[model samples]
Target: MSSNTLSAVLEKLIHRLCLNDFPCGYGTWRKTKGSTEGAETEETDALLDLLSCPHSPWRQDGSWSPQTAALRQLAVLTPERLHTDFIYSYFTTLHILDKGVSVVDDGLLKFSKLEELVLSANKISEIPAENLPSTLKILELRDNWLSALNSLTSCPPPRLQYLGLSSNSLGSHDVVCHLTGTHWPQLVCLDLSDCEFQNQQALLDALSTLPCLRTLVLEGNPFTLAPSYPGLTVDSLPRLSYLDASRISPEERCSFSSLSKITDLIEDRASATVSVGRVRGIPDPSMSLDENAPDFPVITYGYFITYEFLSHQTVDLCCSQKVSESKCDAAHVTEDIFSDADLQSNKNLSKHRTSKLTWAECMDFSDTQTYIVSDLGGLKRFFNQGLYLTLEEEKVLSWPAASEDRKGGKEKESPIKSGSTKDKDKKKKSVPDLVQDAPIRRTLGSVHVPLQGLVKRGHKVDVLCDLGTLHTESELEATQSLEKDLGKKIKEDKKKEDKESKQRGGSGTKQKNTAAFKGRGKGNKESETDVHTDNSVSVQLEPLTVELSVELEKWQSAAEANQLTLPHKSKQPDLS
Candidate 1:
């Protein structure tokens, strides 16, 4: 071992201690002169006097030289001193932080009276049970590289009360079995947070044997995301008072009382069913236009709902492993193909490199015209934080009488434009332009429906969300501008078409019979008058209120005979 190692440094310090005598004090053996003559006094009296002295070496000092503190502490103790005396006379806590300790050796066992051993933020991979003292009550090995506890658990400290093994890789189920009450019977607090433990039932069942456990921290574990979570753990272990630093209240205890039954304790998979129902109270866009017009322009509307929700899906480990292997092979092949001598090739290779893998759950939002029924992986997200549903209205205006004219005009212009421009130069217009030309859509309002309370009602419940009669200023302004622009464009197009028609009819009708020509001209004039009257009309619209219903169903894990079946949606209903 290196001389800078913890065991080596401690061993070297112990060798410098005075073993034959109490190095801090002077002793004198004298007979009592009053009653007994020639009687010798014990040497312990001098040792006690030295301990009580203000300048005793055993006394800790804030001003003590850091280089000599270890030597002074060693000098005050002798080999013959009792472990209990050492504990009471000196310190019983040993804190070693950020030390490059790769292994725990027997050198620590020399501190027989140690009650607390904190070896946090070290590189320790193994802690042999023989190296641990029986008197230790608190053992904190946080932020270490420990992957298994077999050796330590083989002979665990009998009186251990608090064990902090957080931020380690002790994720295997077999390793967790050693943490039962059979090993550490007196354990009162245990911290296994940030570990890789994936099976919740196994961990909970193993920890339930602890008779005195009160505080348990299991945060940052994969199983922590399970919907059952703290409730399942609380009910499984009735003696527990605190979970992940939060105190379990009596009401929570009562709610999870059913979980205490062994029959009810089953492993759960992440799955849920969300059903969006009928929407009501959509405003008529035609109401915003003039009511007493001669001829009203045809107005069509399409309504849809947009909502953001948490979608959970479980990924197969085997499939992920295969994918990762294939990706690695592909990367190797690409590296071989691109030579290091070519700087440009290297840069191009870097651009194509795969990004870091992620397993995070993100929010998923969808837009649908009617009711939506989706099967999600879990309802944990909804239970933690609710979702929002937005109501949107789409309005499309069409002039049925002039539809044929517009189609004929587009057909006549298509061939001329196609012959003038090359195929590469002829690009389609962007989406915004198309949207601005015809349809106008805007959000009516959004309602936040909290699913937490609804979940408590039952496994499945219907939720009615009311989007109040409030629309944002931006939405109202955009809709108004779109309507005004569309109306103006329609009137301008109608006027141009009327002028062209009069020019064409003027020469032909004048050359023909006068009576028939006058009748035709009068009919054309009346049609133009009606179109002009419709264009001059306008109306005020009232505030819109929207209400939607949704059905949410949650499925919990079950045993072989009690398997849960998810609600199936065969066909979506048209709520438009």
Candidate 2:
């Protein structure tokens, strides 16, 4: 029989057994103090066995009620006792935690006026919304095995104001979306502390759309580890008053707003720069090093420098030749690159941003010198010295020709040499004369320091280091020997290939002579056949050679026409 029909029949049986004093006369089963064990009475045993009878809907492991082990003292409190209005109507709240209640018992369905339910610490995999009464306002289902939120969507509690679903398995993004739509309109507080959402952004985004959500508990979640979570959460959900149990301060909100605006502006600027198709970080070819340029110090330090200041700023350095080529009326190109409006904007934003140094005063660079340190001493020593260095200028030691340009020069060399046959006749070019590549610069061996120690205060000093030459005679001799050996090997290989080809050609000619003279003694027929073959080969090659010449002439004519049209187009533009 169904739970309802069996409940009805049991109710009648209980009423017949104790007609007037059924539930109130015998006091409710009391816990035995200091007694941990209790044997089941015959009546309770019979009732339990009947509940787990064959074909029962609630039977699991062939046991009478898997969830009622803690209720061993009151095993006789069957569905019949709970079905009465006198017993069920007396309670509006129920606490069934740690009871192993896998199923929402038929006994709980009788509580039509139930307002609060605590089913935490149980094996309840799911909650039947239809089984739960509509009067429930607060449902605490913490530490359960519920994997879905479909129960709430199916029979949504209209008056549910508080829900505690911490440490549950309800982590689906779809469930989060379903939650924000048309369910729990009166829900003002929600506790989903440890739901383990994999997509944190989706969860936060869905929560942003909840109109009545004020306080939210998301402690122990992976999203809490994000560095900007506080700012992002406050920015995303403006209505959220409390997040992770902390109140959102007004100052924090203002800071988040400013940060968001700055990020958006940076993104827009980057996008605009990209769309303009301007190449960045490439040094212009015209910017050659000025050998006569004077040395300039970029930093200074002394006892007079009581205060130190630091700033995080970006500097844009362009090629000097490019600056000159712009041909603007301004005295300097740097000023034009950094416009007045942009400088003012940077100055305004600088007030809001903090500097790294402890002191704020500026330094006086007059009567001070900064040393150029070698790369041998790394960052550790530099940081200990409290010195700063900025790369003011760089001089490229040598410029290498591009591969395409070098290949083109090589291809044109043959044609140029053919026309200049008289020069080759006079004297052949040497290997060094033919090679067109920049020589490697000599490395500095030893630097000469005039003074090593720190100078006295207010003393003008010029420290000069004389680096010794690194190109030794022995090294030069070794390089020349290596190059000579490589050239000799290349020539030998070429000569060997030519000798093998000549030998093969001689052998082939001998074999052909024998075949042509086979079964003949100085015969005229053989000579005639050879003459015919030679004529036939020449006749076949004549048309191909003529066609190639004609095509070459046509191409040359087209190129000449294009060259003539270019000046006419240029002259027309100039005249206009």
Candidate 3:
């Protein structure tokens, strides 16, 4: 490593330490094994895929629950993974905690120094504890269905510090704790947390006999809190230094005592919040419905954001291997061709040159300010000029690189220096000046990027210049045409909406059909009555005329009042 490299690394560590843990977002990480296809096997690749999953929106996936997807992606988010070695090595503590690790098989673990055994909180139902590590210090059987402690009748771990029987639907607490005098003599720290430790005195008294007993954690065991028989105070038992009978306080001797392997707290709020709770929308479908789903459609959207990896120029290919991409002439190329992709003109090739390798033609952004380095490594340095990236949270494919040849061509394509031609012409006209010809020693190779509106969502993202595949040309055109069509449709929709609005406005001024419909049966009955008895009807007509006049006046007032509501539609228009 160069001094410059060391300095860069130190600077990055400082920067990272000072930064608030950013939420690993779209492009936080990408798949290590870039198949752009099926199931990922490698953890790094899986990690990358998990990190990158949020960035890509699948057109066919309307049922993708974001929380569930995040959970699946963050399976390796636990602290044990930070040591990576823990996942691969297990010679220290005879271990068998293959709880819920769905994909991992038993063959991977070495189980040499592995002493602790926790098959709790898993799909596992039973196991022979006797055959486990003789050095096993703890046996976590919580959250599983283990009905008997007799399964360990043979030879349990000699130095077993803890035995968790909590949450198992197992009966016979007496038999489970029956090992105090016999089979499991070294059981010191026992966690019957959430277990039916109902036989308190029997269990506690039996447990009290364990000569090495120091810690008893009986969380969620309500029986422990029940009124002590006769008059025993809860704290009267004084053999233990720590007793976790209730919920752990943040100040509770730093969460877990000396017995826990997991960290008490994960301080990275951004990462922690991202993994909180079971992923939503799994085994729950009622969330997608509304009181009235028949009337409207629903939609969801996502955007991908990005940054550099590892805040440095060179990237770690694995745990040790490193690769540095050299940057030259302020440009880079991204090509799909592996062999003969680069087309070097025969004229440009020297006699000694045997073959031309075409990685791909490169393209530079319109006008960007960049240093003219002799190689591509310098370009990567530009990305890390700020902070450590390489976070897989925001998984995004790298921006396209421009080839040296193309960059060279682009460099030539740049506008010529002003006034240089005039100066050269004058020198050419004068013989003395011409004879005094001196090569211009002063040179400039810096490139200034021209300003352009970037992709709105990808503004912070590195722009990958694509020397897209030849077959993709039609796809590109189709995409462009689609965008144009969408724009056109949007404009048309607006116009149609405006026209409808205008028509409504024009019609709103007319009298509303505010007059109530006359009640039917009574009017027909009255007409028949009038025909059947003309003389009789004429006599009653005087009274009817007076009542009808008064009703007419009242109806007119109501019509005026109802008209007020009709214009309300015109006041507020739907923006969507």
Candidate 4:
């Protein structure tokens, strides 16, 4: 039973349900809630279970009824229901025949009014669609044993939208040819996710023309085919608004700010080899990172390739000089050699394309760096072996390498000797001589050498590594031995400076101190002199007191005539 049939059946049942005509197929065995002869009851448990089953029914009786059906809208399976004649008479709108139901055939055409059909998770090996109804709109056929979709050609429902054909075992040309034929007119959402599509060209070409397609989800699909690289779905789905092709290794969430790995590319398959490609990130639309920010990121990049035979075109740094002749060999060069044809006329440029390495040219620098770092801890030794560094160890060995023996076991000495003659005109000033790489005496008791070298000759002898790092406390104290060498010089200089300062200063240094003390002493003497003068005056005042008293008595007599009391309490404060 399809959705149309189910809907019609439900509408009819809701309007008029005869309980006497249809009691559930439980056979009156389960305890009853009511005893009314024709009263309607809700079959919640039985009805829900029936929705997912085949076109059969458990009727209003004590047993199963494969012939008769009962429900609001859902019609369920009664153990075994196969052909159209069994379920056609009943009306159902949404039929779910999935998983174990591999028995459907032209019997599906019986539900002429179905709007939604689901037959997923089944073992349906083949579907002959000659009897497909036109009323069908939404169809779900996921997780099935389907290999071809070509059956939908003639009777393809014009109103079909939201088709979900995911998790199907589809792998054939017919499926491709059928889906590629015409646009699903009303189709807006198609979920063909996890279908493992092998024919990507046809799929992309067909889907690009879908006028109504807006939402396409194709996660976990291996999307690649002939002449095309994997992940074309990410590029071809132009109208898709959301994409989730995150990496498979780390289930961890993405850190979009670190997406600046684009700088590693100088050429890519999409930009260099193919005419079509998706932008790394859209500025106006957030198709990549920092969606809240109103700017699209620009990817920076460079490219590389593997070289089969690398030669040189200019002076190589490791070029050997003929000792007696004192001249460099022209065969050695500064860089890799180019093909004769490339040097003359760049034959590959005839196609009006700028010359660049394809996947076939030179080795990637990352791989080379990884190799050098693994063995030599950095690229320093790799470059030295290739372009510089004459090895003394090669000469010290009694048994030299076959190549060395064939050439002659003699080694080239460094151009410079320690603190030697300054006749620089006798030699060309290239990089520093290897002899300078010997241990440098930085402290008193022990010697050390620099781990790094001059980047250029004219560069200053600035500290590469901190001197403090190279010494222990004991080692630092050992360097105090320098004070012994400079003992006489430092003391003599100090004495001379002290003598000169004393001569220039004269006696004025003590004059300021002495003048301050002298002023204080004079002030004390002045106070002492005043005290002495006061004492002498007091002695003289003692005799004059008698004369003053007589005068004071006479004055008191005069004051008494003016009504003043003798100058006792009258002239004094009140002690009372």
Best by lDDT: 1
lDDT of 4: 0.37
Model 3 per-residue lDDT tens digits across residues 1-576: 332221232233223321112222223332334445435333445443534566643211212112323333333343233233432232342223322422223232334455555554554445555446556676677686566666565556677778877776543654655547466677677776555444445565566566776666654443332222111112223445556643323343332232111112111000000000111111111222356533111222111111111111111111211123123211222212111211222121111100111111221111211111111122222222322211001112111122122332232221222258887577446423111111222111111221111101011233222111122223334456655665675566556555655565644432221111122234444654564454221111111000000000011122232342234225522211
CA lDDT, every model vs. true structure:
0.54, 0.42, 0.33, 0.37
Misplaced by over 4 Å in model 3 are 1-109, 171-174, 229-238, 245-576
Taking all chains together, each candidate's TM-score versus the true structure is 0.43, 0.34, 0.28, 0.31
Say which candidate scores most in TM-score. 1
- lDDT for each residue of candidate 1 in 1-576, tens digit (9 for 90 to 100): 776455775554434433334543222332224435333443444544554469877444322113334434333433335243453335467676775777787867767777888888988888898888889999999999999988888888888999999989998977878889898899999999877677778888899898899999987665554445556787788999998888989887776675545434334433333444444444444445556542223455555555543332211112112243345321121112222233322221221111122111211111111112121112333443565666665566444332233443241222213454564244333111111136676776777766654333334334666675543333466557656765676567556656666776875554543455456556656755665456533332333333433333232322211333211112212111
Q: What is the lDDT of residue 71 in candidate 3?
A: 30
Return the lDDT, model 2, position 350.
Answer: 16
Clashing pairs in 2: none
Taking the tens digit of each residue's C-alpha lDDT, what string does model 2 give over 36-65?
A: 544532344544454456774322331222
In model 1, the Cα lDDT at residue 110 comes to 66
Any runs in candidate 2 off by more than 4 Å, and if so which? Answer: 1-83, 105-107, 258-576
User: Given candidate 2, what's the lDDT at residue 6?
Assistant: 23
Better of 3 and 4 by TM-score: 4
